[model samples]
Target: MYRNNKSNLKLMRLLPRIGVICCIALLLTAAGCSRVEKAEKDDKILIGLSLDSIVVERWQRELEILVATVNELDAEIDVQIANESIDKQTEQIQYLIDKNVDVLIVVPNDANAFYDVLSEAERSGIDVIAYDRLIMHPDVDLYVSFDNVEIGRGISQRLIDELKKKTVNIPEEEIKPFKLLIINGDPKDNNSKLLNEGIYASLQEYIDAGFVTVVDEAWANEWREKIAKDLVEKYLSSGEEIDGIIAANDVLATGAIEILSKWRKAGEVLVVSQDAELSACQRIVEKTQLATAYKPIYDLASTTAKIAVSMAKGEKIIANDSIYNGYDNIPYLKLDAYVVDLDNMDNVIVKSGFHRKEDIYRNINNGK
Candidate 1:
């Protein structure tokens, strides 16, 4: 009887083990079904956006408009912001690729980086769109941005006009050559190069004619405010006479303005900038900065979102222009850009509903 009781105890233990195995099997089956269901849902089309950095106000606006547009299309989009890290961005792209995203939109930190990984994504049948900044990769499917070159030209032209006004009182022969400083954006950014190209093109005649001279040039890393401020301060402390500055973007412009304002030279030095950030517009009203090249963020972001969704749905993409990225004439959708000064700030920025009038004119009386 003791032996029989021991045998029953062993069977009871075996019964518990068997029940545990059955429970595990059921759980595994449920997990497999969940994955299959997710796979089926992913078939509807998935878009992955890798933003270089939204640390700037401009990029934040870009993200907001892009997400709103994607939701309107009833499409799914996953976004990853790299905050200006190439390695982190590469890893993010890989994760999206592993998720089998149908389309990948990348605003690359470095134009030269990500050619190989983006190529792999292309090989996997994922459409890649270069957002805002051009990705110098042959595998990139499309480039969407405003005319950066035109923005450069516009800002440069505005500087030249302002310089002329500042020099108009002097005799033609006695006019001091206008000394201009060039504070470019991140060297790794392709848009910086394009902006420089346009600026140089527009200012070449004046430079050659000796009416203007580039006194100093520096490239701000990552468009960091402190770096730009230090560069400008160092130049100013050296007792250099700076009549004008062509700061690549508003953030860099802010740095230069801070230094110039501290030195009490903000009114004398003509500063040209881009991005039309709210602070820059206020500075324009304050007459501390000159014109800003305003590229409508909503237009660029909404259009890019639409393209990504359509491409994900296997539709044809028609580009308005072509840019050769060393390997191919990559299709491009270039949008228009405008120069905004205090005079038309209302027409361009406020009327477009981009910014509330009260916000832009916060520091000024009706933006003067």
Candidate 2:
């Protein structure tokens, strides 16, 4: 009986040991699962920014906005500027992919060249946003830009209005077609393409009714100033009667002005430009250029940062009504741009602290 009692106690002790082991196993499994869930939630979303060209004034502004905003959102980002080479952009994108970024923001050198990188990102469940330029493809997830058509039409409307305000000796009925020379932006840029389309849309009204004559329409290669200067010189050499110039961007406008200066054109050739870069604003105030479409880079960059933060946290981003990104409509947000002219130049650009009055007038005052 004593031996039986001892065996019973021993069995009871074994049962408690088994229970403790089972509890430990369950606890370990639960701990492992919790760690995985936390890891998924807490991962730092790596975002890569690939800017096509570093040469333009507006691009630097864009970079500053996006970088500041993304950092503010507590996510990590890597930015690369390709200096306008399509091949360089492609390599930069592939390099970003190799680094395993969770999101990629691309201002592509060409609309179609970066599709391969996008494909890889899509397959890996990474999100991609096309910035400034629209990446026309089937796979891109989000798009952010201003209403480019509106920007174009806006520029045209402003030009037409400004010209109307200028001195006119000809009778309304005897007015010939307002001769317009165009220095279009880089043909490959989707934004420039849209702006061009906008110009046509607005100009067609005057064109079809015979109120406007297109003296020359030259699309710049990579939107280079040298290319624009060369093309403008060629047109001048051709002896076409040119009146006004509608340069798609500030740089192009400046290039056209350089050529016009060689021909001693000031009030004779009205010029339309965009970006409201310090020089562009200065030119407008000095009466060398007409106006610019000022796109608020701060708004765009801040919004992008907010979205990046939400995405990194694996949270949902609210979609505005979808916009067609060439292939199909997708969720997007578009900001508006302002048109700044001499009348509003002090209020719009200089007062906004983008430029200084003394700097603008010093050169003209000295006559150098």
What residue runs in model 2 are displaced by over 4 Å at the alpha carbon? 1-43, 166-169, 318-321, 357-368
Q: Cα deviation of 159 in candidate 1 (Å)?
A: 0.8
Best by TM-score: 1
Query: Evaluated with lDDT, which candidate comes out highest?
Result: 1
Give per-residue lDDT, candidate 1, residue 339: 99
What value does the lDDT take at residue 64 in candidate 1? 90
lDDT of each residue in 1-368, candidate 2, tens digit only: 11244335434534554575556557678566665445444555578899998788778877888888777776789998898888888889888878867677888888878777778766555567787788877666677888788888888888877666653776788777778888888888888888988888888887887777887788888888877788678877788666778888999888888998898876478888778888887778788888889887777777876776565444564556456767877666778888888788667666766666676555677523
Worst 10 residues of 1 by lDDT: 1-10
Q: What is candidate 1's TM-score against the reference?
A: 0.87
